[model samples]
Target: MRHQIASVDADHTSYLYEWKLNGRWNKLGATVNSDFVPMKPGSAEEFILEHYWAITGEAMLTRWNTRWSMCHGV
Candidate 1:
């Protein structure tokens, strides 16, 4: 699987990302899971993120990074 960061919000609260699967983009769909809160400076927030991939009538789960780094310049 391959992915690219499509976009990120100005406050870095939301990230728009996309993934390529089976030679296509967003074929299985993508999910962005988080608390949906802005990060504080020099601090980390608790986040629950997961990515679901559908393959051959089965669902496969992929965990995202629990810690999201605050963007220095957005």
Candidate 2:
């Protein structure tokens, strides 16, 4: 499995991806400006997404654990 981080700049959006390789998260590839305004998926090229830490502490922890396990093939 892999992990991805999404961020927005002005009117543009970007996604950065990483893979857990050798116990370390390493940079992979990214997609940018692949959507239209008001937020509709556009065809620019690339893949992405997931929300950030806006949930409860426990929920955040659970999310991380789940992702960690998936990355490790656990």
Candidate 3:
């Protein structure tokens, strides 16, 4: 599986990045210009986590819980 990050920039431009992951993509989220900063080595997770919350209006923990429960039937 892969985790994909997609966003639209301030100029209405779009970008995407993909990373391998062990889980499926279901409760995937989207980010916008305000949600992200410059991406550098070793900062992918931090950037995604920050943008995830900014876009979802939920904490990372809560979003993960909800996604897990919904997808895993837990």
Model 2 lDDT tens row, 1-74: 55556655554444445666677776544444434433223322111122433443333322110112122312
Instruction: List clash counts for every candidate, in order.
Output: 0, 0, 0
Q: Against the hidden true structure, what lDDT does model 2 obtain? A: 0.38
Error of 3 at 57 (Å): 19
Clashing pairs in 2: none
TM-score of 3: 0.21
TM-score (C-alpha, index-matched) for candidate 2: 0.31
Q: Each candidate: RMSD to true structure?
A: 14.2, 12.3, 12.4
lDDT of 2 at 11: 40
Model 2, residue 37: distance off in Å is 16
- Candidate 2 lDDT score at position 36: 40
- Flag the better candidate by lDDT, 1 or 2: 2
Residue 22, candidate 2: C-alpha displacement in angstroms:
1.0
Q: Which pairs clash (backbone N, Cα, C closer than 3 Å) in model 3?
A: none
Q: Across residues 4-48, which tens digit of lDDT does each residue of candidate 3 receive?
A: 443444533233333334553333333433433443434654467
Which model scores highest in TM-score?
2
TM-score per model over all chains: 0.20, 0.31, 0.21
Clashing pairs in 1: none
Candidate 1: misplaced stretches above 4 Å? 1-12, 27-74
